[model samples]
Target chain A: MIIVAVLSIIFYLLSLYRGFLIYPGFLLQVAYMLIRGIQLERLPLVGPHDTLFFLSSSLVAFAIPFMFSINDERQFVGSVSVIASVFAIFSLLSRPHNIPLPPVLRTYWFELHVGLSFFSYALFGIAAVLGFLYIRNKDQETEILQYKAVLIGYCMFSLSMIFGGIWAYLAWGTYWLWTPKELWTTILWIFYSLYLHARLRKEWMGMPSVVLGIIGFAVTLFTYLGVSLLMKSSHTF
Target chain B: MLCPAYISVKINMFKKLLAFFFSLRTAIWLLLALLFMLLFGSLIMPARPEFSSLNSMPLFDWLGENKAGITWWLYGSILLLSLLTANTLLCSIESLIRKQQSKKWLLIISPQIIHIGFLFMLLAHLLSSTGSFRGNTVAYEGSALALPNNLAVAIKDITVELSPSGYVSDWAVNIEYLSDGKGIKEDYLKPNSPSFYKGLGIYLKDIRPYPVKTVLLEVSREPGAVWALIGGLLFMLGTVTLMILKIKKESSS
Candidate 1:
C-alpha cells in the first residue's frame, strides 16, 4: 500500500507538468482506497491516514470533470494535482493502523457521514484552488467554476451534516452536541453560508468572494483536523 | 387622521425595520457574527471548566446556571441566531411577495423552502432544549429499573462477544418494557441501534462481563427527533433542487 501511494504521488507530481499523468495517479489512489476498504471490511475513513487518502482521491476525482470542462485545463489540472499530491504525501507520512471498527462506527449512517464530509472537503479544496487561480489570472470562467464547486460542495456538506445528526440521535439520543468538533463544523457551515450570500451582491463578486472561498477551505481543514488535534472532542480519531 | 406627519414617520420606521430584516446584507453580517461567536465558544469551551457543563444538561438550563463570563459567547450566539432566524423569515416573505408574478416557480420557491427548513431545524433544537430528557443507569440480568410515567424496563439477558485479544467484538442487551408490572413490549438494544418505546429511547452504552454481566443504558426522550428529521429532509430537498436548477440554467446559457 505504501509503495502504491508513493507511486501515486510520483504520478501526481509528474502531472503538474504533463497534466495527463493525473489519470494514472487518480487510478492508483482509487486502487489504494479500494484495497484499504477491502482489508478493513468497512469504509476506510476511520483514521487520519485513510481519510487523507480519501480526500486526495476525491480531489482528483472532482478535478477530472473540471479538467475537461474548463478552458484553462492545464493550469487548473496542475494546481489540483499538486494539492492532491500534498494530501497524499501527508497520508503516507501518517501511520496506518488497522484496528477493529468499533460498534458505534458500524452503522451505514456513520459511513455516509464521514464519506460525504470528506467529499465535500475535497470539493471545497478545489474551489479554493480555483479561487487562487482566478485571483492570479482574473478569469471570469474560473470564478464561475469556483462558484459551481462551492454550490455543489455546500449541498453535499449539508447532507453530510444531516446524516451526522441522525447518527448522533440514534447513538446518543441527541441531534446535536456542544463539543468543539460540532461547534467548529457549525462554524465552517456558517462561514460558507456567508460566502454564498456574499456572492449574490455585486460588490463582493470579484476579489472578496474569492478570498472567502479560500478562507472557507482553511476553516474546512480546521474543522476536519485542527478540532480533533487541538481540542477534546469525540472526533479524536 | 390626527396628524399626517406622525403617520408618515411611523410608516418610515416600520419600513426601515422591514428592510433591515429582509436585506441579504443583514443575513451575511448576522451569519458572520454567528460564525465568530461559535469560533470563540469553541475556543473557550476547552479552556474553561464551567463550559463543560454545557453537555450535562439542556442549553437553556445551562445558560441560566453557568457563569456569564464563560458563557457570554453562547449567549451572543443565541442572540445572533435569533436575529438570523428573523432575517430568514422576513427575507423569505419578501421574496415570495416580490416574486409572486414571476413564471419560474422553482427558482422563486427553492430558497424560501430552504429558509422554512432552517426554521424547522431551529424549532427542533428549541423543543429539544426545553423538553428533552437523558439519564444513564446500570443494570444486569433480572434487574428492573423504574422509569417515568409508571413504566419500567427489565433486563432479560445480556450477551457480549469478545475477540481472543480481549476486545469487545459485539454486544446486545435484551430488555422488556413493563407497565403495571406486566410485560408490554420486548426489544434488544445495541450500539448505534436504540430501541424506542412510546416517546422514550433506550441505548446500550456499554457492557461489562467482569464479575457479573452488566450493561450501561442511556434512556432519553428527544421531543425534537421527528422535527429534526423533517427539517433535514426538507433542507436537502430544497438545496438539491436549487443546485440542479442552477446547473441546468448555467449549462443551457
Candidate 2:
C-alpha cells in the first residue's frame, strides 16, 4: 500500500515535468490498490486507515474522466495528485490495521453510508483546491471546474446523509442524534447549502464563492477528523 | 377614505420588506448568521459539558433560567435557522412566480422542489419535538414491561457468544412485542438490527452477561420520521435532477 502511494506521488511529480505520464500512472496505482482491497473481502472503508486510502483512490477516480475529457484539466490533475498523495501518506501514518468487521457493520447500508460519505469528502477536497487556485490565479475555467466539483459533492453528500439517517434508524432506534459527530456533520451540510445559495447571485460568483468553497472544505475536514479527535461521540474511528 | 400619500408610503415599505426576504443578499446573510451561531453553539457545548445532558429540556424552560453562554448561542442558532427557512420559502415562491411569466417550468420548478423538501424536513423535526418519546429501560429474561398505548415488550432470551480466549464476542437479545397479552412479533435486537413495532423502535443498547442476564434497551418513537425520510428523498431527487441538467449544459458548452 505504501509502495503504491509512494509511486503515485512520484508519478504525479514526474507528470509536472512530462505532463503526459499522470494519466497512466494514477490509473495503474489505483488499479493495483483496488485489486488488493478486493482480495481483502470488503471495501477499503472500515476505519480511519482504510477510509483515507479509499478517499485517495476516489479522488483519483474523480480526476480521471476530467483528465481525459477536458483540455484545461492538466493543472487541476497535478494539484489533485499532490493532495491525494497527502491523503495516502496520512492513511499510512494513521496506523493501517485490518479492522475486524463486527457483525453489526456487516450490512449493505454500512458500506453504502461510509463509501458515499468518504467519496463526497474527496470531491469537496478537490473543489477546495480548485477554489484556492481560482482565488490566486483568477481563472474562469478553474472557477467553473470548482463549481462542478461542488455541485457533485453536494449531491453525494446529500445521499450520504440520507443513507446515514436510515442506518441510524436501523442501528440505534432514532434517525437523528444530538451527538457531536452528527451535529458537526449537519453543520457541514448547512455550510455547503450556504455555498450553493451564494452561487445563485451574480455578485457573489467570482471570489466570494471561491472563498466560501474553501470555508466549506474546512468545515468538511473538521467534521471528518476533528469530531473524533477533539470531541466525545458514539462514532468509533 | 385613506390619505393617498400615507397609503403609498406604506405600500413602498411593504414592497421593500418582501424584496429583502426574497433577495439573494438576504439569503446569503441569513445563512452566514446561522453558520456563525452554529459554530458558536458547537464550541460552547464542549466548554459546558452539561449542555449535552440538557438536550431533552424544553427551550422555553432553558431560556427562563439563567444559564451559560452556550444555551443562548444554541437557541440563537435555532432562531436564525427559522429566519433562513422563511427566507428560503419566500425566495422560492417569488422565483417560481417570476419564472411562470417565461414559461420555463422545469427550470423554475426544480429549485422550488428542493426548497419545499427543506421545509418538509424542518416541519418533521418541529412536529417531532412535540410527541417524540425516548427512554432507557432494563428488562430481565422472561420479564415484560408495559409501554404507552398498552403495548408490552418482554425479553424472551439472551444469547452471548464468547471468543476462544473466553472474552465476550457478540451478544443478542430476543424480544417480543405483545398486545392484549399475546405476542405479535418476535425479533432479535442486536447492535445493528433494531426492531420496529408500529411506530416505536427497540434497540439493545447494552448487555449484562456476567452476574445478571439482563439487557439495557433504548426505545424511541418518532412520528416525524416518515416525513423526514420523504423529505430526504425529494431533496435528493431535486438536487440530482438539477445537477444533471447543469452538467449537460456545461458539457454542451
Candidate 3:
C-alpha cells in the first residue's frame, strides 16, 4: 500500500509535467486497498488507518470527475492527488497490526454512516483547496467551482447526519447525544450554511465567501481528526 | 375614521421590521452568532466533567444554576438560535409570498419547505426537552419491569455467541411487552436494533455473562421523535429538489 501511494504521487507529479491523465495509478491503489478490506471480512472503517485510507480513496474518486468535466481542472486534480497521497501515507503510518472488527461496529449502518460522512469530507476538502487557490489567484472560475463543490458537499453532509441520527437511534436509543463530535459536525454544517447564505448578498460574493469555505474546511479537519483524537466519545475510532 | 398619517407611519414601521427579519444579512449574522456560541459550548464545557453534563441537558435547566461561566454563553446561544429560527421562518414566508406569481414556483418553494423542516426539527427538540424520558434498568431471565399507562416489559431469554478466541461475537435478549399481564409483543434486541413497545424504545445496552447472565436495558420515549423524523425527510426532499433545479438552471444557462 505504501509503495502504491508513492507510485500515485509520482504519477500525479508526472501528470503536471506531461500534461496527461495519470489518475489511473491512484484509482488502482484505492481499488487494491478496498479489495484488501473486503478480504478481511469487514468494511473499511475499522480503525483510524482504515478510515483515513477510505477518505483518501474517496477524495481521489470524487475529484477525478472534475478533471473530465472541466478544461482547467488539472491543477485541482494534482492538488487532490497530493492530498490523497498524504492521507495514504498517514494511513500506512498509523495502521494497527491486525485488529479484529468489534461486535458493535459490525453493522451496515456503521459502514453507511462513516462512508457517507467521510466522502462528504472529501468534497469539502476539495472545495477548501479551490477556495484557497481562488484567494491567491482571484479567479472567477475557481470561485464558481468552489461554490458548486460546497453546495454538493453540504447536501451530502446533511444526508450523513441523517444517517448518523438513524444509526444512533438504533444503537444508542436516541437520535442525538450532543457528543463533542456531533456538536462539531453541526457546527461544520452551520458554517457552510453561512457561506451559502452569504453568497446571496453581493457584498459577500467575492472574498468573504471563499474565506468561509477555507475556514469551514479547517473546522472539518478538526471534526475528523481533533474530535476523534482528543475527545472521549462513542465515535472515537 | 382612522388618520391617514398615523396609518402610514404604522405601515412603514411594519414594513421596516418585516424587511429586517427577512433580510439575508440578518440570517447570516444570526447564524454566525449561533456558531460562535456552539463553538464556545463544545470547546470549553467538555474539558470539565462537572459542566460536561450541560451538553446533554437542556439550556433552560442549565441556566437555572451556575456552572462556572459557561452557563451564560449557553443561554446566549439558545437565545441566538431562537432568533435564527424566527429569521428562517420569516424569510421563508416572505419568499413564499413574493414568489407566488413566479413561473419557477417549485424551485423557490423547495427551499421554503426546507426552512419549514428546520423549524419542525426545532419544535421536536423543544418538545423532547420537556417531555422525553430516559432511564436504565437491569433485566434478568423472567424479570418484569413495570411501566406507565398500565404497561410492562418482561425479559424472556438471553443468548450470547462467542468466537473461537472467546470474544463476544454477538448477543441478543428477547423481551416481551405485557399489557395487563398479557403478552402483546415480543422482540429480540441486539446492538444496533432496538425494540419498541407502546412508544417506548427498548435497547439492549450491555450484556453480563458471568454475573447472572443479565442485560442492561435503556428505555426511552421521545414524544417528538415522529416530528423529527418527518422533518428530516422533508429537509432531505427539499434539499435534493433544490439542488436538481439549480443544476438544471445552471446547465441551461
Please, what are the lDDT tens digits per residue for candidate 3 over residues A58-167?
Answer: 88777776666544566676677678778777877886435566566788777778888888899898888788778777888778778877888888888788777777
List, residue by residue over A49-159, the lDDT tens digit for candidate 1: 888899999999998888877878888888898889888888888888688877888899998999899989999999999999899899988888888899999999999
lDDT of 1 by residue, B152-180 (tens): 99999999988777878888888999999
DockQ scores for all the models shown? 0.85, 0.57, 0.65
lDDT of 1: 0.89
Interface RMSD of 2: 2.2
Instruction: Judging by TM-score against the true structure, name the best candidate.
Output: 1
| lDDT: the better of candidates 1 and 2 | 1
Query: Could you tell me how far off, in angstroms, the CA of residue A167 lies in candidate 1 after the best superposition?
Result: 0.7
Question: Which lDDT values do the candidates have, in the order given?
Answer: 0.89, 0.78, 0.79
Off by over 4 Å in 2: A23-40, A69-73, B1-6, B54-68, B101-104, B162-172, B208-213
Interface RMSD of each: 1.0, 2.2, 1.7
**Stretches of model 1 off by over 4 angstroms after superposition:** B1-4
- Name every residue pair that clashes in candidate 2: none
Which residue runs does candidate 3 get wrong by more than 4 Å?
A: A13-16, A19-22, A69-71, B1-14, B51-68
